[model samples]
Structure formats: C-alpha cells, structure tokens
Target: MNIPFYKMHGIGNDFVVIDNSVNSISLNKRRVKALCDRRYGIGCDQLIVLSNPKNDLADVYVQFFNGNGDEAGACGNGSRCVIAWLYRKYHRTEFILQTNAGLLPAQVIDSQMVKVNMGQPRTKWRDIPLKHEADTLYLPLAGEPSAVSIGNPHVTFFVEDLSTVDPVFCGKVLEKDPLFVEGANISFVQMLDRQAMRVRVWERGSGLTLACGSGACASVVNAVRRGLADRHCQVKMDGGNLIIDWDAENNEVLMTGPTSFSYQGSFDLDHYPL
Candidate 1:
C-alpha cells in the first residue's frame, strides 16, 4: 500500500503525519518502526495519524506513535504540527484536537507559531500511575525527582548543571523503573531563574530527541510545584525554546511554539517491509 504523508516538525521534534479521514491507513508496530528508520524510511521522532473524530466535539482525532512504535497518549509538539496542517486545510485558527489524552483546544498564534491548551497536569500517584504510592513532589528515589502527568507520565530531575546528567543513561534507567508502571519520559532540568529554565529530555520510546513537548510542559509544572519556577516560564531545549504557562485561572497548561513543514510525499509499504 502507498501511504501519503506530510513530514513536519515542531521545534526539532519531527513527525510523519498521515491523514486517514479520506482513506484508512492501517499500521502495525513493525511497519511503524520501519517507517521511522532514518536509513530505511521516512525518519521522524514520531508518526502522527489523523482521522475523523470519534467524538462529536472534536474537529479531528490524532494519534502519536514513537519511533519505537509505541503509542503515546499525548504529544505536545505533534499536536502543534497537526494544528498547522489543519489550518492549511480549513484556514481556521482554532479547533479541538481529540487524542487518547482527551480533547485539546488548539490555536494558531501566527504563521510559524501555534498554541494548545494541554489540560491540567495530573499530580497524584494514581494519575501518574506509579506502581507504588510515593510523593510525586519528591519521590523517595535517587535525585529526588518529581512526577507529573500532562497526558503521559514524566519524571523530572532538577539539576544544577545540565552537562553533568547523562540523559540517555539516566533516562533509560528511570523510564523502566518499577516505580512507573507506564514508562516515564525523563527530563533533566536546570533552572536559569524563576521565569526560565533549560531542559534535556529522554523520551520514553523516542530516546533523546531534540525536543519533547510534553516533557517541557511537565518540566514547568514540576518546577512550579517545587517552588523553583514561576507559573509561566520559558523552557529551552536543544532544538529551541517553548513558552509554557501553567495557567492559574483555569489550571491548564498552555504551550506555544513554532511548527514547520519540511516536505510531503508518499511511500510504498512494500518497498521497505520491516
């Protein structure tokens, strides 16, 4: 089967987006992983599939799969790119995006930038879905990481020096730790001040990407909960920066960042069968 796709990115976290509203494009784990292989296929950090909304309130339904072929509940940057695609199709500035995480209200801030309401952060043990109950603000683990769930789970370690923490090593260990029933996205955060911070993310299945959108939102929420950052702060990642606002008025996390389309094309699944 030949699949049409749009290659897009938010900051530097890229995705292969396929619209399935017109024609259903089914993918299995192996095929999804193969499509994300840099040498063998259309490489990207994740694959985004868009289809007609299952819920009446949403404009479209979006699903995200990491390069490793694991489906994720929420993707901050992926949602932005999806919104950008929708804007080109409908010429609309705002709409509701439905995902496993829920309905996210998205908006177009400008030509290059987009914003989305990512809902409130989930801070309880059951919400983060830890295997065992532990204080989310200060887990009884090494590095005293904080847990926050925007849609997926995240464990953030506040560090004084970003260079000292090995994201791949630490992230791998903590991601699969027994503490987190569902593997967690690990972030090493360094506070520049109350209004700004630097972050490096080891995404659950994508490894260390240039940026992780939900990781950034989790970082800000964790920082504010720990009294290390303001409600609104700037999170700088390797790809670029994102403005994350943990809105006090509505308890929603608002993320604003730039999204771009790299190209668009079709690939035959038979050519690279994994």
Candidate 2:
C-alpha cells in the first residue's frame, strides 16, 4: 500500500500531514505510531490528518495524534502547518479549521508566516483536567508548574537557568504525576528578559521534542498571570522562537510564527502495515 504525504515543520517541531480529503486513508493508533517511529519509519513528533470540513462552519478538520499513539486534542504548530498546506493547495488567504480542541481561525500573515487565533487559555484545574484544585497559575507538582490549556494541557515550569535543569528527568516525572490525568507537555522555561524566555518541552506523548507552540503560548499566559512576564512575550524553544500575545479584553490568545515545508512525497506504507 502507498500513501501521499507532505512533511512540514514550524521552527524545529515537525509533522507528517496526510490529505485524507482526497485519499481514503484511516489512521489507526498503531499505524500512526509506526509511521512516526524514527528507526522503522518516517520520524515525526506527531501525525496530522486533514479532512474536508464537515460543515460550512469550517474549511478543514484536523485529526492530531502524538507519536506515542494517543489521540491529541490540539496542536499549535501542526495547526499552522495544516493552514500552510491548505493555503498552498487551495490558494486561500484565510480559513477556519476545526480541531479536537475546538474551532481555530488562521490566516497567512505573509509567505511562510501565519497567525493563529488559538482561542482562550484555560487556567482552572477542572478545565486543564488536573486532579488537584487550585489556581492554575501556581500548582505544586515536581517543581513550579503553571497549568494552562491553549488547545491541550501544558504544565509550564519556570527555571532560572536552562542549563541547570535536566529535562529528561523532570519531564518524565511531571508528565505522568497524578495532577494531569491525560498527561501534559512539560515546559522548563527560563526568563531571558521581560519579554523573552527560553523554553524546552517534553511533549505529552512525544517525550522530549525540539519545540511545542501550544506550550509556548501557555507559558506566556501563565507568566502574565503570575506577573512574571507581560501579556506579549517571546518564547524561545529548541526549534526556534514564537511570539505569544493574550488579549484580555477579548479573552483570546494569538500566536505568530514561521512555518516551513520540508518536502512533498508519497510513501510506501507496506513497512507500516495495519
């Protein structure tokens, strides 16, 4: 069996995108995991399946999955990549896409740049799906973790230095700690200045990854709530930099970043037989 795909990336975070709109392909957990395997398949942090919108309310619907095979509600970078793919294929300047997280409005700010309205950030423990009840701005986990939900759950831990902390150890412990039932992307963030910070992520099911856009957005929102950072800040991840802004008046968060297309091709799925 063969399938068509487009490998795209934003910063260093990458995805394997399938045009399910035209191709009759169904993504099972095992097949998605197999395709994302670095050694045995096309390596990627997540797999995004793009299908035609189910109604006039949306232009596209994205099904997202972590490399570990768990279905994810939303992904910021993946959303941007999907928009780019749609823009490139459909030549549209603006569009609305439906995600597991909810409706997302996206537009091409310029060639290779996109702005995404990622909706509101959830700060309540119930909303973030954390077991403990408290202000999400300050929750006790392994370290200083701020629970915020952009599209999915994220625990942003602020550190003074990026080099001092060990992500492998911290990320593993905090990701599964009973606080977050569905697990969370752990972000160790170090403030560089009032408006900039360095971030590293142990993505929920993907483990350590180069970047996480939703994580970045959540971190800024947490920082602002805690008075650590302003409403607009730059989150520098391993992959690259992302600008996050929260509009208090409207209760919406906007993330802006650059996206890239690595290449386009069809793959033989025989190696990952379902």
Candidate 3:
C-alpha cells in the first residue's frame, strides 16, 4: 500500500506525519521504527499519525511514535506541527488535539508559527511515576535534577555552563536511570538570565534531537519551581528558541514556536515489513 506522508518540523524536531483518518493505516512496531530510520526510511525524530478524534471535544486524534517505535504520551513541538497540518486542511486557527496525554488546545499564530497549551505539569513522584517516592523538586541524583511529567517523564538539570556538559553522554546515562521506571527525557539547562536559558535534550526513545518541546516546557517549569527563572521564559535549543509560559492561574504550560513544512511524499508500505 502506498501511504501519503507530510514532512513537518517545529523548530528542528522533525516528524513524518500521516493522515490515518480515512486510510487507517496499520503501523506495527517494525514499520514505525523503519519509517523513522534515518538511513533506510523517511527519517524523523518522531512519527505522527492523525486519525478521527475519539473524543467528542477534540478536532482530531494524534498519536506519536518515537524513532525507536515506542508510543509516547505527548510531544509539545509535534502537537504544534499537527496543528499546522490541520490548519492547511481546515483553514481554521483553533483546534483540539486528543493524545494519550489528554486533550490539548492549539492555535495557529501564523503560516509558520503555532502555540499549544501543553496542559499541566505533574510534579509528584508518583505522577512522574518514578520507581519510588522521591522529591520531584529535587531528585537524589548527582546533579540533583528536578522531575516533571509533561504528558511524558522529563528530568531537568540546571548546569552552570552548557558548553562543559555533553548532552549525549549525560542523556544516555540518565535517561534510563533506575529512578525513572518508564525512562525519561533528559535535559541539561544553562541559565542565561532570569528570563532566558539554553537547553540540550536527550529525548527518550529518539536519542538526541535538534529540539525537544516538552523538555523545554519541563525545563521552564522546573526553573520556576526552583526560583531560577521567571514563569514566562525563553528556552534556547540547538534548533532555535521557544517561549514557554507557566500560567499559574490556569495551572497550564503554553509553548510557542515556529513550524515548517519540509516537503510531502508517499512511500510503499511493502518496503517495511510488519
């Protein structure tokens, strides 16, 4: 079967998006992994599938699969890209996207920019679903990183100098730490000021990527909790910058960034076995 796919990216985190609403393409683990393989397949940080909404309140249902073919609860940047895709089809600015994480509201800021409400950050150890009870504000780790669940688990480490920290080395070591039962996205953050910070992330299942949207949101939330940064701050990643605002009154995190359409094409499913 030939499958039509869209290549889109928010910041530098790219995705291969498929409209499964009508076709209802069945993608097993092997196919998902193959589609995300840089050398063999379409190549992307994650694969996004759009289907008819299961929830009445949502405009569409979005499922995210990492490069390793594991399903993830939520993806901030990916959500914006999905919204952008929908905007092109419906020509609507507002949308409700249903994911494993829950319902997310999104708005198209422009042709190439979008903003998404990532919902609330879960701070409790049990909510983050750590192996055992530990302080979410300050985990008992070498760097004393803070843990938060932005639909998915993430641990943010505030470092003094980002140049000195190797993200790949630290991310690999910490992503599967015994403390995180479900594995975690690792972020090393260097505070540039009270309102700006630099971050490098190791995304769970996807390894290193240009950007991690949820990682940026988690970083800002953790920074606010620690009084290291303001509620609304700028998170600079390898790809670009994102504006994250932790709305205290709403108890929600809003992420704003740019999205792009690299191209669109179709591929044969027979190339990837089940």
Candidate with the greatest TM-score versus the true structure: 3
What's the lDDT of the predicted structure labeled candidate 1?
A: 0.94
1-274: candidate 2 lDDT, tens digit per residue: 6789999999989999998888878678898999888888888999999887876799988898899889898888988998898899889989898998889999998888998999998887898898768778778754657898887898888888889989888889888988787888898889988799899989988998888889889889888887889888998988898999898898898889999999978888777776
Span of 10 residues, lowest total lDDT, candidate 1: 265-274
**Can you write out model 1's per-residue Cα lDDT over 135-168, one digit (the tens) per residue?**
9999989989999998999999999999998999
Give one digit per residue, the lDDT tens place, for model 3 in 82-111.
Answer: 999999999999999999999999999999
Better of 1 and 3 by TM-score: 3
Rank the models by lDDT, top first. 3, 1, 2
Please tell me which predicted candidate would have the highest lDDT against the true structure.
3
Ranking by TM-score: 3, 1, 2
Worst 10 residues of 2 by lDDT: 135-144
- lDDT of every model, 2 decimals: 0.94, 0.87, 0.95
In model 3, which runs have C-alpha deviations exceeding 4 angstroms? none
User: What TM-score should be assigned to candidate 2?
Assistant: 0.97
